[model samples]
Target: MDLIGHVRCFVAVAEERHFGRAAARLGMAQPPLSQRMQRLERELGVRLFDRSSRQVTITRSGALLLEEARALLDRSEEFLACATRIKDGQSGLLRAALPSGLARETVAAILADLHQHHPSVELELEELSTTDQLARLASHDLEVGLIHHPCDVAGLELGPVLRCELGVLLPRASLLAARDEVPLASLTGLGLVLFPRADAPAVYDDLLTTCARNGYTPDSLRHGQGDSFVHGLILSVNAVAFSPPDRGTAAGSPSSEVVWRPLAGAPLAWRYSVAWPHGRKDTAIHAFADAVPRALWNTAAVSTDPPPRPLHLRPASEYWL
Candidate 1:
């Protein structure tokens, strides 16, 4: 019977008090509109209007049904609005995890842009390591992750690696600090602070392979568990640690005791990427992916050389950034 359509026809007739006027308002012929109202009354088993040759008037049953009919139309509109919002990634929450190792400014820029673009997307952020981000993401605890490694997890996929060149951070009082740029081989026998290989195997191994490739191998490797501890280790006057050049200077200030020097003839890098669970399609995920800027894809500011092995990339063209 197209129940809602019939009810709307009846409501129009009741309001207009004339079938001719109601049909004109509904943009339909008077005969078809009259038939629709008659069909609605038959379905409800009640007379909805008192029809006379002069005018039309609503019955008690029609008055009672009109209030419910209006509420139903309002609810239908509200439902459509909510469904459209979900499809467009406009009104849901996205739980995203980021690594503590990402350049602070890099993280800040990404977050700021996300807020501006997807303001309705409630962001619940967590600072996790790359390994932890992958695990939590797999379990569905997180919708998106900004991780620095493990780009090849079984259930995860990503776009081009966000690569950043590595530089040596040292005490300003040390001999190595005097150089504008330090060669990879020059730090071979010095006390070097590094991430424990067990913490991030692929990333840590890549750095080691870079050192060995340049004909230099650290004689002393102080495996620091965290960046704060590693930075403190490098501050001890002898130990040197690798970091991205603009890392600590993101706020435009360098530490008085620490000086940063670029690595010569080397391609030490921090390779990171945006990753998510495979086959998990969600609008918030799509919005987050698109919000990330194109500039972040290449953080390799100092080195013209490539990684020992090219980073694996899966282009995200279908997502429409």
Candidate 2:
């Protein structure tokens, strides 16, 4: 019955104290406004107004309910305003994720940036591998993700691509550490310490293929997930791990007994971008996307340039002719 709307009509007519004047104020004809007031009165089982040919006066009952009616309309307006803010992404809980293997400092910086810009938004962050992120994003369980390249992005909208060049991380005692840069071919006899294939299948395959093409096939592939674990493998197993450049201290340094050196030709690079489900980008998602590049650049020293080639291509296996 649009009871609130009837109350609005009643309030206007009561305050104006004349049917024609109230109708003019409400931008409606006098007949309809009067009819609505009568309906409102019947619905409430109370006579709300005393109407004569020329004048209108509010009944005692109408005066008694007027303040309550005003309060209800005020609350309704407030409710709609709040819903609009949520729809616009100005306030809400945003579920987001980041791939593992990111430096702790990088993650902290990203969180700080998001908070500074979106103080009203509550970001629920998760640490997930690229493979797990893809599955959750597909199922609509995640709202946004920062994902590595060479992964399937079939139904997602991606942000600007950023690249961090990969270097060799080896025991500083190794002979190869003496070189200004290590060529892939130089590490032929060493095992390759890497994350598991399941972490990111396409990236894993691509890394192996590039290494093989460059004449450095590892003696074995060792899997490790944490920095300490991966570093432990490199030191104990006489192997090398590919890593991003660090400032001579954090990523296996003088005290850590490991060192990071650039590749001779920069054969491998990590590319990543913030992504969300197609058609689901909102204000909060955009805020997160906007914060990522700056955070990566400031903390991880990543380059914001677009990669030379596309990140992924659908496998030909799906074709049926």
Clashes of each: 0, 0
lDDT tens digits by residue: candidate 1, 65-171: 88888788778778889878776667667788766656655667677777777777788888877767777888889878776653456687664455677788777
> Compared with the true structure, what per-residue lDDT tens digits does model 2 show for residues 1-321?
888788888889888999888889989998898789888988899998887887888889989988988888899898888788779887788889998877778888888998898898889999988899899999989999998888888999999999888899989899998898999999988998888879888878777877887988888888987788888998899898998875334855457688888999989988899989999858999999988878889878787756536476424322111
Ten residues in a row with the worst lDDT in model 1?
Answer: 312-321
Model 2: pairs clashing at backbone N, Cα or C within 3 Å: none
The CA lDDT at 88 in model 2 is: 86
Distance from true location, Cα of 131 in model 1, Å: 1.4
**TM-scores for the candidates:** 0.71, 0.84
Model 1 clash number? 0
